[model samples]
Target: MMNRNFNRRKKFIFFLPVAVLIVAVLGYVVMFLWNWILPEVAHAGKLNYWQALGLLVLCRLLFGNFNKGGGHNGFRERARGMRAKWDSMNEEERAKFKEEYKRRCGGWGHHRNKE
Candidate 1:
């Protein structure tokens, strides 16, 4: 177990620099593209490498979710857990739960109100 853990750590350490280098290359690509296209097409200001990196981060913050279920307090994970619980329920319990939901709210299928 210790050897396995150490091997994993060694791999991570080895890959970390490569990952950073990839990200830096991508940032430079972004800078190049923005400078190449946007300034001429949109009359936008040119961006330096650092500005491009900042733009990458800003776009990630605004439009991306990379939390691996960390944000929202693991809401997706909790949803999966609830699904597992439902799957583990016996037939009677499942039927009873469905009936209770239909009673309190509305039913599925034909039970729905036409109006």
Candidate 2:
């Protein structure tokens, strides 16, 4: 347990600086792009490094996922659950489901030509 804790601490110490560097680089990139592009095209004011970082945080809070695994695992898990449910359905149940889905959704390829 002590060794495991030491390893964890070492990994955290190593990764913390890398993570900070990455965030700092992203902030600089945001600042550069905003300063370079928006001033001429959008007549927007320039952002300092801290403002750029804040904007990044704001955008993330508004429209981004904060999941540690980058937010796709939840989708995969849901898809897996759906597939399992589908596989567990009997033929009659599956047919009924398909019919109901078609009725509700107007059927797939509803706009396609029959020919």
RMSD of each: 7.4, 6.1
Q: Mark the 10 consecutive residues where model 2 has the least summed lDDT.
A: 106-115
Per-residue accuracy of model 1 over 29-76 as CA lDDT, tens digit each = 999999999999999999999999999888777766445642366678
- lDDT of each candidate versus the true structure: 0.87, 0.88
Model 1: residue 106 alpha-carbon error in angstroms:
21
What is the per-residue lDDT of model 2 for residues 63-115, given as tens digits with 9 covering 90 to 100?
Answer: 66555756464788899999999999999999999977766767566853332
Candidate of highest TM-score: 2
lDDT of 2: 0.88
